[model samples]
Target: MILLQANNVMRRFGADVLFHDVNLQIQEHGRTALVGRNGAGKTTLLKMIAGITSPDEGTIAKSKDLTIGYLAQDQGLDSQNTIWAELDLVFAPLHKMEKQIHQLEDQLASLDPSTRKFQLTTEKYSQLQADFKKRGGYEYESRMRGILKGFGFEEDDYQTAINSLSGGQKTKLALAKILLQSPDLLILDEPTNHLDMNVLAWLEDYLKSYQGALLVVSHDRYFLDRVVSDIYDLDNHTLRHYTGNYTQFMEHKQEWLTAEWKHYEQQQKKISKLEDFVNRNIVRASTTKRAQARRKQLEKMERLERPETDDKSIHFRFYSEKDSGNEVLDVEKAVVGYNDQKLAGPLSFTVRKPQRIGIIGPNGIGKSTLLKSILDRIPLVSGTIKLGANLQIGYYDQEQQQLHPEKSVLNEVWDDHPNIAEKDIRSLLGSFLFVGDDVYKLVHDLSGGEKARLELTKLSFKPINFLILDEPTNHLDIDSREVLENAINEFNGTVLFISHDRYFINQVATDVLDMNALGIKHYEGNYDNYLEAVNKEKATNANQDESQTTTTKPKKSSAQQSYQQSKETQRARRKLQRRVDKLEEEMTVLEEKQEAIKEQMSQPEIATDIGKLSDLQKKLDKFTTQSEDVELEWTSAAEELEKFDQENS
Candidate 1:
């Protein structure tokens, strides 16, 4: 059954139409996601569907008695009641029923057994009890507790007054309350905001099993991929539905665009040919009839509109004037904190040239603090940080404090490089989507996304070989994030950045740094890779625990067995180390071969020689493939060896 439907929904802002002739529907237990570029009217559409606003040109209809629980982006609860009390409001009807049931029970105890009043009271009491059970009266508190805990509210926090909670906490409480209500349709806009990785995982699981249909609007591609099964892309003043997760949607969208462009171009060619034939023959007397027929056919034909292109994105590449040394940065036993208070530390890590390292951790675990310490913006409590020779560092602050808010957007970039011409400065700003009159806007007036783009424009303008970024994707839309990812991948530099955007990390990270308050754990791949390794570690630990519990050996035998296991582990480590060394040697040789072939291909004589160039290109390709294989093997072996050594130590 269709729970809700929007037909020909049209919204307008002032004189301009945001979108029109929009249509969407949600069936019972449907999971739909609304996605679009920033300012493409996604939130507005959601608000219209949630009945917070009215559409200008269409109707939104829902099933009779349909209930909707809408959680807007960053929508917080404003209540004087305690956290538990606020959530307990969801059970008000049940509470009232329970009260009446108790009153009925009290009356039954005093009334005569054969009296009509007693019989009527007994019947009412039985019906109330049945209704209470059907409505989950007994499990409501436990359900509330489960939801509150899932949103990170503990029993201790239950009594805390809602007015005292932080904005993020209040938002969480609002979500918890709405979830407990369990409306027939749950509408969430950016619900993943302010949620930690663990909480995000929990929410994903919870929503997967949710009883109601879900309609969410979020830029979190990873979360959407996990939670939503369908995607509704609002673009170019229209909505297009795709039947898959975000990843699959991207694939299907590309294919669809390709096909649409092809069809459009083909129709254009046919129209052009017909028009040309008519123009040439229309003046000739003998062929005037044919020309008229062709003209009639042309008049009867329908022309296809040009396919919309996604060219409205900021486009730029990251370039380095010079290369940094092989060792870009090295931090040993580093403790990062502020004012004698430790946040996260006793950490050690090394960044090599051309490596993009993504640092991830729960909120407030000091991932950003680590970057500041490395930049010497804050003093480290202990340990040392060293930068290798010829290294030029570029930092992108999450707070964007580096940007002078008082300066205009054009002046912001121009002030940094005064030698550049005004035209060039404007051109650079234009590439970042700060066009015509936009460049004159003060930095303070720009939106968060605009400031982010402007900051990136400045970063791109510099000639640096090392990038240290903190939450770089904080305010970027999905398209802008993809552009930034491409720029980072094309950069010939080392990058150490902190990000909570898993899709961005997966796209750009060469390694993952999992940080915690206690310490840091290094993983060899992206977010999914980190999760895989973590699961394997958990399984191994569980197995060890089970073995310990079931062990029957004496203490001495166990000690000897441990010693033998240690020896075997050492042997395995040695073998892995040897494999790693050999692969590294192979990779070095393959890289040299590739460079030599490229140099040969670059020669003026060889460049002009097609066969010679082709042969060298094939050789280069073969060596590159081999190099990638060897690197993968080396990574696997090195990770295994690192684990073994850490275990033994």
Candidate 2:
């Protein structure tokens, strides 16, 4: 069944048309995503479909009795009630039914058993009970609690006043409330803006099992890929439907664009030939009739317009003028905090040359604080942070605090590089999409995305070997984020950044630093690899626990048993240690071979020979596979040895 439909919708802002002839439908239990670049009228169209605003030239129709729960971008609750009380309002009808049932019970107790009034009251009470059960009255509180917990609210937080909560928390509460309402359709705009990885995972799972249709606008590609099955790409002031996840939609869109361009080009060539013939031969006496016939054909033909494309995005690459030492950064037993209070650590980690490390943890666990501590912008509570030689660091602040509010966009970059020509600076700013009058806009007047682009322009203006970025992808659209990823990959520099974008991390991070209140755990690969290793470790611990619990042997002398266990443990530790050492040696050899193959491939002479390149490429692939296998084996063996030592010690 169709839950909602927008037919021939047109929205306008005075003389400007945002989008026209937009059409789409939401079916029962549909999972749809609305995607586009920033400022592509996605939010505007969503408002019209959600009935928060009216379309200027079309109708939005919905199924009879349909209920919509629309969550605007960063929309928060403005309520004076306690958190629990606010959520409890969603079950007001059930509560009222419960109260009536209680009143009926009281009346029944006081009335005569044979009276019609008593019998009528009993029937009414039973009906109320059935209705309440059907409405999920018994499970409402539990369901609310589960959702609140998923949003990071503790039981103690239930009594907290809604007005006192932070903006992000209030937004979370708003989503939680809407979810509890369980409307016929849910419309969310950038719901993942304030969510961490853990909460994002939870929300994805919840929406997968949601009982209603969903229309969401999000820049989180990873979330969209997992939760949504249908995509409506709002581009060039129109919507195009594709029946698949975000990845599949991209593939289909690319194919469509290619076909559209080919057709347009073919039409353009035909028109050009006809026009040329008409222009050159119409004045000739011999070809007058032919020209007239060609003109008639041209007049009857429909011309194809140019294909539309989105090319107004920032483009730049990060490159280091000089290389840094192997040790880019070294943190030894570092504890990061504020006002002398410890937040996270004692942590120890070493960043080598050209290693892009992604720091991840819960919201308040001090991932950003650790970055500040390393840069000496904030003092570490204890321990040391050392930077390697020949290093120049560029930091991208998530808050855009580095920009001066009073400064023009042109001055923001030009002031930093006064030696450069003004025209050259303008050219550079134009590449970041700050052209003409936009270059003169005040920093404070620019949007979040504009500020982000301005900041990136500044970062790219200098030569740096180390990048320390905090939530770099926060304000960027998916396209811009992908561009940033490409720049990072192409750069010959070391990077240590904090981000909640799982897709961005997977694309750029060569390693992950999983921080906790206790310490930081190092993983040798991307986010998925970290998860796999963690799961494997948990399974190993579980198996060890089971083996210990299931062991049932006859009791032996205390001295003998102690001796035997100690001896056996020592032998096992030795064996594991030897295995670890052997794996480490094998890994080193494999890595060296891979590096050698890469060096050979990079040579100019070898690069020009197709046969030689192919043979070298095959060798490189084989060595790369071997290296990864050995690396995994080495990681496993080292972890086992570490666990054994900790337990047996």
lDDT of 2 at 52: 89
Error of 2 at 2 (Å): 1.2
lDDT of 2 at 227: 84
Q: How does each model score on TM-score? A: 0.83, 0.83
Best candidate (score: lDDT) = 2
Number of the top TM-score candidate: 1
Q: Per-residue alpha-carbon lDDT of model 1 for 423-458, expressed as tens digits?
A: 999998889888899999999999988999998999
Model 2, residue 84: distance off in Å is 0.7
Model 2 over residues 315-345: C-alpha lDDT tens digits?
A: 9988678879998988999999999899988
TM-score of 2: 0.83
Clashes of each: 0, 0
Q: What is the lDDT of residue 350 in candidate 2?
A: 95
Candidate 1 residue spans exceeding 4 A from truth: 544-649
